[model samples]
Target: MLARVVEANERWERLAAQLREENAALRAENEWLRERDVRREAELERVSAELAVLQRLVFGRSSERVRPSSPAGEDDDGQDDQSGQGDGPGRRQPQKASPRGPGGRAGRRDYSHLPRVEVIWDFAGGGYCCPECSSPFEAFDDHAFEQVDWRVTVRVVVHRRRRYRRRCACAGPRTVTAPGPPKAVGKGRFSNGFIAMLLVERYVAGRSQNSLIAGLARQGAQISSSTLAGTCAAAGALLAPLEEAIVARNRDSWHLHADETSWHVFTPDDGDGPARWWLWVFIGADTTCFVMDPTRAGAVLARHAGIDTTTGQLRPAEDGGPRRLVISSDFYTVYASAGRKTDGLTNLYCWAHIRRYFVRAGDANPTQLAYWTRDWLDRIKALYAAHDELTDAWNASVAPAPGRAAVEAAARLDDAYTAWDTALEAIEVARQAQMKSPGLQQPAKKALATLDREWDGLAAHRDYPMISLDNNASERALRRPVVTRKNAYGSRTDAAARLAATIWTVTATAEQAGLNVLTYLTAYLDACGRNDGKPLTGPDLQRFLPWNASAADLHTWAQPPETG
Candidate 1:
């Protein structure tokens, strides 16, 4: 009896220890769940903030913002409320009611009012043409006819240049080339028209390449993927010099926008890895330029901003230097201290970015953070409108300088600065309140504080007119790669990625300049092949753009004007 009791006590003690261990694990899991919930809530808030800013920027109103449940409906501008039915494959606008007839009823127009066409019937063939003449009658020729309309798809011929070669009687063979072919695409596989069509289908038309090819095939043009790629690649190589020239111009420009995004590239590993890609866009009130480089570091900025790495700052040209650059970018530490010579780089922050944090966290703490963010966004909206109005007034009246504009842009800038100060104060107070509140968790507090700390960058544009009020240009440029990422999944090799970047650089630049991408690309390729002549330059290439000139003009511009 004593031995059994001792055994029973040992078993009971072991059971008790196992139960304690299980309870401890359950408690740890519960804590982890709470932490995860906090983090998720914070992420949701950030996304909300971003959407609100995007809403205002794209739609020009904050109150009209709607959450997109599916990615299918959202457009490039983030407007998804546009219905696809009537605008797409559904009921069309009702046509106006037909005019009443003579008796107050609808009737066709009188043929008597129109001139009569001549009709001839020859009684030369056996068929009865003219009953008056019983002899054999020929086919009836009718000049009088009814107009008919129908839709038919046909393969339109873009000119194909034939190279003529002649063998001299005594000497060697001579070849006459009719200024080669258009530069936009390669000669052997694709036509200039097709390449232009491709760009239109992909970018402006927003259709996938597969869809484009299938659509073309239905229209009787069977183009393979390899052929399309080759044509694009060749044209891209040709247009490379133009991009360089644009970059050269940026060296003398007063403002530039810089941004980067993740680009996935396939490797010989288990899964795809992340590759950082940089996109830099510069606009000088007139022209726009875009570049896609692989590097993410400040070195990419150094290359485009003309920074001398040794001195760790920007280097002006030999003659003189640009006065200032109103740079708009995310608060990356690298650019904050990017060594600018003499006058420090004028750093204008994006208010759109600053307002996003609070909007994103609204659901978690809707009362203070959300309300405060909305108020700050309103002030930023006023600032944006003021600048736009100033620009429009200057444009309308042809003002010589920013200070002399119809809107007094400089004064507006000062006003904007004051607004930023007020918004900043409000944001800080809300942030502190969130941090102190027990109900508000770390994620919501941290995200708000981040925007609060970056106030200088968030409100940078108010200092100068030359600086943009936001990083919209850079973000707009990033959208191209993002779309490409979804379609191609990613690139296969480093070279492939480089090739894509090269193509994207010129293609995006062409779009920005309102050039017909196909025409420019084809002409560029033709010019590239004629390397024996003067190498094509950017300004020269600009004249051949499709938007600026007709296809014939581009063709003529691709070659020297016969050197007469």
Candidate 2:
């Protein structure tokens, strides 16, 4: 009986061991399944977020504005109401409307600068007499009122050059004829003024070539598309020197805003399809330049901004000093790559771009993450407000050159800087705390990651007060070209693409200098015509640069050209 009992115990022990091994294997399998389920859930969330973003982009508004929610115990006006008392019983207080002057309408504009024409009225019989009484009336002070009128006409100008005959015929031709008027194109039909109008209409006004042709036809001028294209080409060739000068000035600026957009080029196929091109803009305080390139790589930035490709550092200035350039741009890797390679170049990433990430996250899943997105957006808004304060203080400090006022202004500026630093610190603390929270969702987490990655660049503006908080200036400079691209579907050839860039550079730079674009183009083309239908060089070209132009020239360009 003892042997049997020991055998039974051994059998039971073996059975228990088998059961333990099976349970361990089952646990491992179950854990793997659970992990797979978690991964699937995360993937689903990401896909949903992406779909939401795509939908918003396709159907939602383009504006990135987000209205902040009111805090507890505060009203919409941002006033505290801790008592929880109502304005009245069962009746809300009415909001006051904004005041508008003179029957809520804008005042009449002054047209004193326009030319005036008089029209006198008389009786039917050419006598100042009343019809009913048939009696003559003495003329009194005339009553008058003004009415603006517009008329567009097309006419041919006939240059009447006089011819004279030499009686002595002394070592010269027997007859001499006066020189004809200058022509923008050699033996071309159009005048310099006509070419200027065509340029402004197509480039400045963003009108297509076909539209220009039709408009001119309506004005009694029959012109073909080829003719207009040739005119633009001729004008572009003449203005190439000026464009180069502008580019040189743009590269010399210490601070600049850079941006780029895609452009389609229908180049001839060389065993390959059409090539994709890019349009780049670099805007300074008083200059704007556009460049067309076949590639959208760092080389374009390097070439235009004078950076050494190998070292990624700016070349030495003309005075042999280190060249320092601060570029404001989006968080493109090329800019960051260049920034990483050198100390002389600094990249200021746009805060507006960082804010856009959170904006998109909030829009993607408004029902679940609206509050979270708004909190982050509010933090960014606080940064902007603080920056505005810093800007105002800095401007005030610089306005008064050297005086007691400047001393006081400098103190205020220092205070503003301190406040700005405090604000930045608060944001950093909040970002860190939120990153550690367990309830964070995938969208918000991704947004935070971007913010963290670009934090140093976003905050770099504090070191240089002259730089702006965003790259809106460069973006604004690109609007005109974008519109033209949409209308014309980009240039047809490489040469045409380059010509577009040159003309756009001149027009945009001229506009930045507060010059009338039409007037500026007309004046420049006339100078080109006088230069024997060739591009201006040396001092002549420098005189045409908007920044180098004299005050008298600027005043003249500001006025509207007379129409006969």
Candidate 3:
């Protein structure tokens, strides 16, 4: 009996020991899991915060949507693409003639410069007249006014015609051809104007197809997404050649600004992955041209600026060809050796680039380097301001204006140039001192050294009127595609990317030149279609541009608008 009692006690002790060991193992596992959960939570929170910041930068807050704000012109020098002539940003279009004026003429200029169309509502022979006076009210401000607001509307129309046919007296077949103007987008429900509107919205205004369809419907054009997309595709096909010709012409200029930005295509990665493409842009000296190549390599640059085969070099010559170019680009190193053996070719380095190095260095160490860099920029700013004021005066004079009074203006410009030279000399001395300063760290010192080395190329503007203070031209040309990358993601196929590059080249160039892009593009395409296999040239393009006679006189060359 004693032995049995002891055995029970031993069994209980063993069971207790097993329970303790299992409990301890569970506790350790729980602790490890708790720590792993904490780490995962922290990682998730960090990623979430970063994503939110990026979203805010790209798309703005949920409560408020962000629209792209146009970039401002960097400088007011006459070299800016904003030379009061281009059709797009910073440039002004010629004011169209108004239909009303003092003289009872048909084409009178409206004296009303502002938008307010004033009218005075006058009550006549009514018992309830003005409260202040029982007498009938007279016209207020010598006019009668009634206000109503209206919005633009677009609609589709369909036309059907029945042909008249007769049997010939000899029992032969006879038919009568009925015709009006050739259709632009054949058998399509939308008007030519509406299709043009769609393109302008997509390309110029930078709206997506969903946004565009919604906006057009709100404006009274009920277009399906598929319809709009199809219209866009057709327009792209029709306008492709004209776009190519415009790029070709621009590639033939004496000087050009070149740059590239990113783009994406749909289904780039077999409908799952993303692919990248580059939108390359080149603008001519007259600020009247543009070209887009899909490649960012030196080969693309070489192709545009003609090459000398034997020397394996690019030379700028009046070869009555496009080779005489002075390219303005960033310090990409790709453009570094372009002017090595090219005659009539010069590489003008960008001051903005040199200034940027100092700007960044100053950000890291403000007290010593930043202040000096800022001071230098302030002087540069002053020089630009003076140059702008002089240029504005010159523009107002319409320089060498067709009269004896123009002599004084010409002389004044020469005097202003002389003063500009003196200011430049002082700038050179300041730049030299910054390079010689030993207080800067390695990065700042390196930046200063580069400035000193490239001083001649950076300050080439002083010697040549055609040279510019910044590479803003190329930078500006690249802005659109960069904006596009965030929304569209990027390009899918190389063909789509090439198409985009071509389109940008033509549109931006047309805008830079103050030519109505749609007007020029449409007319230019029509001419190309009619010319058969003939290649488009600059002179041919001049005939169809917005500034040309054909825009207004479309009657002789173009069929008149259909009369009901």
Please name the candidate that would achieve the greatest TM-score relative to the true structure: 2
lDDT string, candidate 2, 507-556, tens digits: 99999998888888878877887889989998888888877889999999
Q: Considering TM-score, which of the candidate structures 1 and 2 is the better prediction for this target?
A: 2
lDDT of 1 by residue, 1-564 (tens): 999999999999999999999999999999999999999987886676566556545553343254212223232234433312112212123333333436442333222222322323222232332223323233323222221101133233223223333432333324332333333432343434445455545544444455555665565444555555665556556656666655566566667776677665555134354455544555444345555556677777777677777876556656775345556777776667672333446666666565455444443344444444455456556656666654444344444354466456556555655655565455556556666778654436656567667766654544454455677777777676666665555555565566566566666655665555655554555555455323366556665443444666645544421210
- TM-scores, all candidates, are 0.58, 0.77, 0.60
The whole-model C-alpha lDDT of candidate 2 against the native structure comes to 0.75
**How close to the true structure is residue 562 of candidate 1, measured as C-alpha lDDT?**
27
Which residue pairs show collisions in model 2? none
Q: Model 3 segments beyond 4 Å from truth? A: 1-154, 160-178, 187-189, 213-230, 265-273, 285-294, 308-312, 315-323, 385-418, 441-447, 518-542, 545-564
lDDT at 7 for candidate 1?
100
Q: Write the per-residue lDDT of candidate 3 for residues 111-148, one digit (tens) a residue.
A: 23322333222223322233333332222122221111
lDDT of each: 0.52, 0.75, 0.54
Candidate 1 positional error at 190, Å: 2.3
Give the 10-residue window scoring lowest on summed lDDT in candidate 3: 62-71
* Candidate topping lDDT: 2
